[model samples]
Target: MGSNGSDPPRPVVGITAYGEHARYGVWDNESVLLPRTYPDVVIAAGGVPVLLPPVPESAAAVDRLDAVVLAGGPDVGPDRYGAAPHPRTGAPRPDRDGAELAVLHRALERGIPVLGVCRGAQILNVALGGTLVQHVPDVVGHSGHNPSPGVFGTVEVALEPGSRVGAALGPVATVRCHHHQALDRLADGLVVTGRAADGLVEAVERSGAPWVVGVQWHPEEVATDVRLMTALVRAAAQNRTTAP
Candidate 1:
């Protein structure tokens, strides 16, 4: 898992990307967008990082990767979980919702490790037949989940003593966060592995063969806790060897 010549072939990780109106150079046009830090951290963790733009074909691409990083983006459409949009919800992105859902379905079926960050976490919950709080301020009584605009708020997170996240990053830690929503009705098989100081569901995982987890904070933002990403690459390597 090293970048050196003697290292074994690294696990290939396909990271999800979104389409947005972006500004670069002197041009302002709609374009595919992905934070470079996500892939940079993946490479630093000894994985081959590939940015997967939002497209229907993402389902097929999911098959070729050993792991998937569902990057943070817009709010998932409320209709995905049979709820009406919250007054605080941003504009819908049903097209993107469909694309990532397909990736999640295929990754789970193929036993590929998945790390869902921020918006990715919400999407994970929805993909597994769960719902989101839609507006954390409404549920938690404040903007603790997202303290400010364009800034990563710090929050203390307590991990379940025997949970996968706990094993990866210890029992208690601080994480960088920037989100307005959190998990509500968890999927049946999914277990809450961590919580914020305000009791928001900050982390979750399905206890089984395939490594699957969703974190409400942005570890990639501060590059502070790379254990989750590292764990995924490690699992991906193991999956590669055992893959037929």
Candidate 2:
């Protein structure tokens, strides 16, 4: 990990949006009340927390953010990665997909640091020409991965020695997650940094970037898991100056 110079005094980080299912039309609700305790996590890490709306005007959104976060949400569209929908695939939201793709593209093009969680991780894969398992049970031959359909379950992740993820969370660790899909083909330029006990991919990262890590877990829910947020914020602060 290389440092540009003395770190900037402060930086602003943006968390991606998640749509709401209101009674009327999709009310386009915003996450002002703080999602998954991420606001406190960012503030504790010495950064400002900004809730990013699902507005796809890349330049406008990307310009104001020193770093961007892709938070966990609904499943990514299977068609985005050249596959048919799975029997167990959840509702697909094309609007959210398009908006996030634009945000991701703008961030990557500007060399901004990004941290993806759960569905955000899948989105990272699809954005780079990769595919997903649709439903882990159908492929992994087990139902433990998605234990209770919509509940968090513990999984052991095998981390590659000397990988960025390993350095962040240690050699091997257990993480809590709730998902039905897993990565099938890794995105180009992305290396699998961790995997579940059932041999499913758990985390990935770019080879030489400051911080391009994505995990299949909701680290924000575990406030004690400070490493996840620390690593992300540190990398974002680094990119603010060294971004190319």
Candidate 3:
């Protein structure tokens, strides 16, 4: 992805890749994978999408990204929040957990723009000492948030006026959602910027920070909602120009 004559370089957006077991081509295999829509949406938003596998050099790799997407995946282990695992909690992956946390910490320290989606948003809260409602349906009175295993359901969210997410999007939006967890206690310095009809926190933004945001719904899941990614890319490009 590029610009017309003399335009600035597109921001390099790094998206986290999760490891999974798969069968493809000639063999059953262990693979690093990301949904095509994630990167495709990024490119359409005028950014360079780079897949970032969990690695020992993750923090350093984060240093190189102009922006980062903490892609959705398995649950954050209860240990990170110092609690016993809830019955519905997904099995833990220390590798994915460790790698993304390192990248997040480094990115925050450097003030790089960051977007956290679904599990990404959960971990962003966890990373900042907030807790999560392990099984959202148990609290919300419906399994509609995640109608089935690996399925997305539609829901409406109301955005806070004058908030980052509200400003990027409008006062309300119907979005694609697929998750069993969401933010519990508010993280320090992170403000709730959106909420679902059931009143669960749907979005958060860090005040006084350079473009840090988290959304409980998957904006990448739908091609039409590229505003979030575009906002992130714009912030990233601005950060690049202002960086010393």
Q: lDDT of all the models against the reference?
A: 0.89, 0.80, 0.90
| Candidate achieving higher TM-score, 2 or 3 | 3
Give the Å error, residue 7, model 2: 9.1
Candidate 1 lDDT tens digits, 156-182: 999998887888889997888899988
Query: For model 2, how does the per-residue alpha-carbon lDDT over 33-86 read when each residue is reduced to its tens digit?
Result: 237587777777666778876656643677788777788877898889988888
Give the clashing pairs for model 2: none
> By the lDDT metric, which is better: model 1 or model 2?
1
Task: Mark the regions of model 3 whose C-alpha exceeds 4 Å error after superposition.
Answer: none
| Cα RMSD to the true fold for all candidates | 1.2, 4.0, 1.2
User: Considering summed lDDT, which 10 consecutive residues are worst modelled in model 2?
Assistant: 27-36
**TM-score, every prediction:** 0.96, 0.88, 0.97
In terms of TM-score, how similar is model 1 to the real structure? 0.96
TM-score between model 2 and native: 0.88
